[model samples]
Target: MAYDSAHGFSCDCGQTEWQVSKTAKGSQVVCYCTDCQAHLRHLDRVDLLHDGGTYIYQTTPDAVTLIKGHENLALQRLGPNGMMRYYTSCCKTPVANTLSKATLPFVGLPLKGEDPRLGPVICHAHTDKGTSGRKQTGFAAAGWGILIRAARAILSGRRASPFFTDAGEPVIHPTVLTREERRIASLRR
Candidate 1:
């Protein structure tokens, strides 16, 4: 069941290009968290969600490669302590999300243009806040698998992500949301 280590992703306007891992190696998930909802709302595309959930494929930062249009990639945050949401500045297409701490090895890529061979959903996360009222099947098994694999990737010295420099700085500093903007985004949380 080996899969290709590389897969391509891009924005609607083709201003950005990304190389991410395939689903066999990456953790495929459906997230129903408030943060995900707020992220889509911030981009004015709440419609990205299917039943209030977004399909995401998790991989180490090192697994993502910015192939082109690096300058077009931008970052945004919901608040001072929110996940860093990356997008295309040209078309505002949501790209990926990462923890503010560069030491963390995980980044979640939106599965909008993924290949069908990536297979079906593995698990559901944040179901309590899921707006669609649907349950994720095999959550425990899939969640544990992801957790274990992520830990291995982190420990194996693969944290030098494409989104950050070797010195552990974001390629582009994120735009922190103001108090008013945070308040608005938090209303849905």
Candidate 2:
């Protein structure tokens, strides 16, 4: 039941596995962003939002390694300009969330496969961005310690992310969407 791993995590269906850095290398947080809710809604997994929050561990993209079922990784966006969300294509299980452009070296690691060792939520984010009209708590201290940690990572040059190569290109090619397709997907009821 130990979630403290320098190894990483696996999907529910065992179709995908991603290696993560040490638990100390990432930030654990809960998010209530509208986009997050919408993504869950699109996947018909609103039930995973306990207290209207999605628990995730934020880490550098370089810390992740797709150890198995690379083809099972699928991508989605809330809009033409939204962040690229990656999931298991086989079972449609979300694995990570990242920016469309690879400039940012961060990824939100979902806590689906983690043991109870993930510890307390560091902070809540975008609590004011929920679109479901269901008021959720834990917004008073959003983005609390993230800024400092991110700055440290950036300044310290710890951003040699595994998501990209030395040439600054994505390791995996996501299913890019046109504006029209993005519109339809985002507007899904």
Candidate 3:
């Protein structure tokens, strides 16, 4: 499908800006996973969290376009095998999360607030890890949507990633957090 519209988002310092194509095939979800929470805490961006979860638009990396301040973009991981979390060094705004490799073609952009353009939340993931006391929903639909989007992205050649190079390497090297850092970030408030 062709991109129909674009929604812009920027870091707290407004130094890093990007847009997500509306046509991106994926799901809008509120992820309450501990890792998600820890990521925000690691960046000292707990203000981005809502109801003990992070609102994320899970889509293909090809759908994201960096508008400016690419130099401020930074990558980090909670551990050696954790998903790469992208943020802006200028203001510590948690931007997106992705698989270890660009070939995976997935990007989960954390939303500061709900955007009607991305549609409604289709899933409430990892509620068991949430402090909100809400039940998980729409797991099956979200799972199928992810599989379908991933399959289509792979078939389409996984091009145009804002965070990765044409050679499938990250545009910037990732910093793996120390165990102490992870422990501190994971501490309950």
Candidate 4:
């Protein structure tokens, strides 16, 4: 599915194999917060978010898949930890979430590879724009966007945080990371 290399790789379904590449388009979405870094760290993605907070992207969502043994999909709530997070048991592909009242499998990585045209909406999470320290331009914009979104969301009775939404409504509760998870995250630092 990726537009890069084609080295054979294993799929959940043993019968069918997939292709992988060494080079692909890359992105770094600055998170500017610790939770953002922790999420990636929990997934051994610390290196990907090195600049304080940025989700590095390489393979398009469409390029990644669970063509076989999709039944092995297992969801874990790492945010609430005991609450909701999504991963495929077979391959641990970040699938979606199911924590809030927004029904099961609430949120997860999009299968953007399927429809390249539709990209993820940009948002600034945990941003207030009052912290004046960093100088990265895009990071600043993301922070400003976060501030604007938060103001709009709060005023309009909408969810300000974009990551965890309950029933399409912004969750008002705070996210908790376990001590063990935090300790593990420290390793990435």
Best by TM-score: 3
TM-score of each: 0.84, 0.74, 0.93, 0.40
- What C-alpha lDDT values do all the predictions have? 0.75, 0.67, 0.85, 0.39
How do the residues 33-96 of candidate 2 rate in per-residue lDDT, one tens digit apiece? 6677667767766666755567888767766777888878777776667777888878777888
| TM-score quality measure for candidate 1 | 0.84
- Tally clashes: model 2: 3
- Please write out the lDDT profile of model 1 over residues 1-189, one tens digit for every residue: 112566777788887888766533666788888878777777777667766678887767767778888889889988888888899999888888988877757788886633365566677878777766776576787667657767887777666677777787778989988878766764642
Candidate 4 residue-wise lDDT, 1-189, digit = tens: 433453233433344333323332222233445554455566564444434444322233223333444454444334454444444445434343334443221222322122223234243334332132444445555445435534544555543222244555323343456778766764665
The deviation in Å at residue 152 for candidate 3 is: 1.2
Residue 167 alpha-carbon offset, candidate 2, angstroms? 3.5
| Highest lDDT against the true fold, candidate | 3
Q: Where is model 4 more than 4 Å wrong at Cα?
A: 1-33, 47-68, 79-83, 103-116, 127-178
Candidate order (TM-score): 3, 1, 2, 4
Candidate 3 yields a Cα-based lDDT of 0.85
User: Model 1, residue 105: what's the lDDT?
Assistant: 74
What is candidate 1's CA lDDT for residue 19? 79
For candidate 1, the lDDT comes to 0.75
- For model 3, how does the per-residue alpha-carbon lDDT over 76-163 read when each residue is reduced to its tens digit? 9999999989999999987889888876678899988676778899999999988779899988888788778888988877667888
State, as a TM-score between 0 and 1, how close model 2 is to the true structure. Answer: 0.74
In Å, residue 112's CA in model 2 sits off its true spot by 2.7
